[model samples]
Target: MTTTGAVLRIQLLGPVRAWRDGAETALGPPKQRAVLSLLASRPGDVMGVENIVDAVWGSDVPRTAVNGVHTYVAGLRRALEPGRAGRSSGAVLTSESGGYCLRVDPADVDVTLFHRALHAARRSRGQGEAGAALRLYGQALSYWRGEALSAVPGPFATMERDRLRDLRLTVVEEWAADMLAAGHHAELVTELPAAVSEEPLREKLRWLLILALYRSGRRAHALWLYEETRDLLARELGIEPGADLRTLHEHILTGHPELLAPGAGSPLPVYPGGLPPGTPGPVRLPPVGRDFVGRTEELARLEEVMRGESARGGPTTPVVVVGGTAGVGKTALVLQLAHRLVDRFPDGQLYADLRGADPERGPASAAHALEQLLGGLGVDGARVPADSAARTALYRSLLRGRRVLVVLDDAHSAEQVRPLIPRGPSGVLATSRRYLGELAARDGARLETVGPLTAREGTRLLAMLSGRRLDERGPAAERLVALCGGLPLPLRVVAQWLAANPGAPLGALLEQHPALRTRFGPAEAADGVPTGQFHVIETS
Candidate 1:
């Protein structure tokens, strides 16, 4: 009988190697080894001879490819089970239904073990087990002895080798970030430069190297590295360093305290809800209104402001305070703009309701607002500082070099909004009932007053929300818009009531909810300008 009782171990991670019963076995020529590697990639999965030939030779297929496959299989069967009769069926590599399946346990494959360990490492990191994650990462990295699938011939092997190399780099980068967070910068200082040397164009690796050096008290070296990177990036790609690298350089120059390593015995920050580093940041913008209608002019103006000083050829962060009476759709307008411009801000878009108009809760204190904002930034609640000023400083420091959009809804005052504003190139869009003139004068915030929709826009909004075939020019729609004073909230409420109770007339709905008709009280804006003959209903 063949020596098949012992478990077979296959290593496809580095060079193709096989150990049968703890002894290395000859795997034949390169094509035969390529065939074995493909099967090992998916242990126990049946692979057809045609598919194998295609993967091995790609377009330059040989005329005797099928015969060549049979020859390779015979060779593998003889090497893997020398005791089997020449004409007898093989056990380790079996042929069934015109396809071959390497019937081996997946755990015996080094690639499978590597992937499993990497997954576990990410899980541990997400659970705030930084020490465990570091250990697991090291275990996963230990699987790679050199380039994966080294010298294994085939299109499949080439593609898989590239993919595996990329995964290795990703794990390395994530490990470096966790190391820095856990105050192990000294370890990274020794390891990261080698990785950077191998991937000189990868800015993130260089960024981590600089940060690790800085935290390890090599400030001069870190600065020199940044300048070196700037020159390298310019020379190779003909472009300047990205926003993140530039921001990190600036902070390093000033010796920003936020860049300092975590204190001894302090807990390392968990992955943002366990997400892998470099994963997209949290998307916190509230859902946009489905039946939101016009505001072409208003949307364009806000978009320009949200574009920050970029559009104006300046270098200041943009803060636009949307001021208007309640129920005028200021929040809706800003949220819509934020969603449209989401692709521009890859870091994240953060939102918080300041509760400026919440009579029960009153305006949320600046300190409370900063806490909520920090939470969106992935800061652990317990880690937040108690002092308001310290929290604000931390908040600003976290935002350095990131392109985030901060949307503060229903803000109370300039003071309440100021502390929550993000630093650097991030933009802020805040809505408030108050005009916040003080904000404009002091903080250079551009004030955009949201007024009631025009009669046409309001009529269209009602039709869309109610899904009715109402005549845009009909008296019924005109009276409805005029009674609602072109304010989106009351119009929406009336439309929803009509939609829910299909037979309910607009008049009957208005009579039941008299608050819907309260918007026609004044034609004055919050700052005393004539705001057309529109009524305003305060919304929570």
Candidate 2:
């Protein structure tokens, strides 16, 4: 799906609505609205005729179903963009191969906007911006006029209704928690009773409601609410209030000042995922090495992949695969690039080492990696499934609207990082020693080979590491760079040795390591190019 035309606003979260130039443009009939919903649910992805038919008409498809779908597309194109000539290709909804796909900015869809706002709120909360986070969370929740896809009835609507409602409930609880952190206890005291009544089993909501009531000088009401929750749980599931809830009840009974703390400062409800209660920790990008240097082109490629064709819809999920031999600085380069892209992925950054090249341990299973990632995203450990496929599906669902940066280091195969790749504006930077041919050929990964650095780049790296410029020792530094074979890791090691042995000469250090002297003798070897892995093409 591709569009470089006028703005198109399509709302599907609550009711099926389309707007052009801030005016509500009519979207034909029920079938047409269903088609639009199905396509817009997954923008930029082609939906086949059968899937569309199934979603629109279920098993009771008409004999003229194929023709009917074509008619609907034609009608939608005209309704979406009325000026197009007869039989002209649409800029918004394009037909390809077997079916059609909707091309629209994710921000235009209420579902995507809601999710983006939700993540923004989470981030704001993390940064101690409870007021901003509360506003954002409230803006996200406000998108729901009622049950999502409420007006649109079909199998797809039924499926989405349950998913969106659950999400809405979670958002409601999250908003209440943020309000509690922002110290708007009185407001929550008024807002949460009805919500608590709706889902009596939701202990955290009831807890927040109790906290609110207590802080608002309603101690009797707070105790009664807790007792009410305890009785409800016992009556419904034959269990008492959780330990945390019980503890909170006692704290309220004692009139602890801590109970009245800002929602941001209040302890979060414990989730099984080892996350910090409500908010997951900040982007977990490992510290970039101090001595890391010189991957200008590779770093450019990372930026290119992250923002690549966002306007044109170039790659639904852009992936940059950096492949090279051991100690080629692939991981270091990826870390550097990931740190640089922090603002791009505000949802947070995720890193997982596949252990593909570890001698002691085998390559990490995709399922295990998913468990870590899901946990990092604040998913409960018990909530994360055991099956790899299910884990992948859940991971994708979590990543759908959020802009997360995933760094998969030492990946063995494309399959290892495949499920981890975030679709839409999110990106993945995967590094491996082996050339993952399938990634480029089948998975559309932009492959870049990280090779040895130049003689000058190597010298600069050594100087950067040693905390002193080596320009005065130019020829000596050049020889040392050549001697160390321009490989970043070994060169850094050589620099560290030089730093420790202050009195030892640069030449003397190389003379001690015979391998350095041997490789220095051969021009090709000094550049660190293996015979077969990389071929240097030259024309005279």
The best candidate in terms of TM-score: 1
Can you write out model 2's per-residue Cα lDDT over 135-179, one digit (the tens) per residue?
999899878766677678567877877888778888888898877
Using all chains and alpha carbons, the TM-scores for the candidates as numbered come to 0.50, 0.46
Q: Report every candidate's CA lDDT.
A: 0.79, 0.74
Query: RMSD of each candidate?
Result: 23.4, 24.4
TM-score, cand. 2: 0.46
Measured by lDDT, the strongest candidate is 1
